[model samples]
Target: MLAGLSADYYTRLEQGRERNPSAQVLDALSRALELDADQEMHLYRLARLVPASRGGGGREPVSPMLLQLMDTYAATSAFVLNRTLDILAMNRLAEALFSSFADTDNLVRMVFTDPAGPEFFTEWHRAAQSTVASLRLAVGHDPHDARLTRLVEEISAASPAFRQLWEQGHVRGKTAEAKELLHPDVGRLSLTFQAFDVRDKPGQQLVIYQAQPGSPSDHALKLLESLSANYRDHEDADLP
Candidate 1:
């Protein structure tokens, strides 16, 4: 009654018999579910506004405009990630801040498969749990996505931590939070992050990290910038 959706229709939706929902119906359902902004967005994606991952290369589709936006952030480290936690794009500083993205392309695998996982993520338990939860949210959007399925299988087989978390069945959407990391060059750093939604492109998030002004992490950022410059000058490699 709240959504003016008939009981039979709602039942059909729940029973997987109804696939299409009008925009107004979707709005009403969002209200009925009492979804917050992020949850509402995730729900729409789950309803297939945009698939979890599209056909093409494994990377998420990053538009030139988005790439330009990422380019604008010189001091701030920024990157784009897909629902599956694939680090699709990043500015030079982000590569430097996170150590190297050449090997850790996928965050899920990085936290589990990489030998330096514990060292890289200072908060290992929290990072591991959050990665699993975020993946759970992503899977809801595209249950049959082959790449995501294979990733789950691989992580399950490799990481006992991931396997235990996966068995617990938790779902959490990505949210902005202060993150602590042990950077190889700069020692320990504290950074705050924002996960922005690409509204026109669902299932894609633009993440930016910032350290507090005048803090040790802030100084470390400057050092990372220097390293980034040197790498660019010498290697001429593209940012990950």
Candidate 2:
């Protein structure tokens, strides 16, 4: 056999009858299937052979230094996300960029379950696919996470599209990509975003969005920034 396993053993493995597969056997199977690094690691997780990498079941606080760094990006949109795509923290511009959503708590929820999602994201289907793929990558890191499990279930129950895409078994982390968004106030925006891992903080990622300088999107971002600032000022004035 390609995996160096007898026919009956492989069949049993496929049928879930073989519960305790050795690391060597998994390695043989991974090699035979030509799995990529992420997929191979996901396989180990599925077999309960790998320990979960995400620590603490609850949300972790964003570092104050990181928060200060985000604040320095006055013209750009920046936010921090946990493994389950929870928006742990956001700068002013980032909050303005997503202000249309009723809840900006989870990226997956924003893309899939939010009523404003489809209209806000110009390329809705592509956004949905990427969001699902990112979540799949997160699952590989911590399959036993209760919050993640609940999120999957809630979205799956509410959205047939989410259910379909999630069943496709795509696994990928968030990567640099161009995003086209339709803002309620500013109209269309074309921006590119990049993701970075927070040092010493496993499962935490910092993402930043920027538009090409001197372009219409760049102007729009500035306008949005001003609008966000004005709105915050008004809210503060009304607090008393």
TM per candidate? 0.76, 0.87
Each candidate structure's count of clashing pairs: 0, 0
- TM-score of model 2 vs. true structure: 0.87
Model 1 lDDT per residue over 1-240, tens place = 988899999999888898877667789998987777756666666677754554323465788898888888877999887878898888878878767334758889889988778887889999898889888876666677788889999999998999999988667777788788898888998999888877766678889999998999999998889888887877765544
Top candidate by TM-score: 2
Each candidate: what lDDT? 0.81, 0.90
- Tens digits of per-residue lDDT for model 2, 87-138: 9999999999999999999999999989999999999999999999888876
Candidate 2 C-alpha error for residue 40, in Å: 2.9
Candidate 2 ranges with C-alpha deviation above 4 Å: 1-9, 22-34, 48-51, 237-240
Question: Worst 10-residue stretch by lDDT in candidate 2?
Answer: 50-59
| Model 1 per-residue lDDT at 18 | 88
After superposition, candidate 1 runs with Cα above 4 Å error? 1-58, 100-102, 236-240
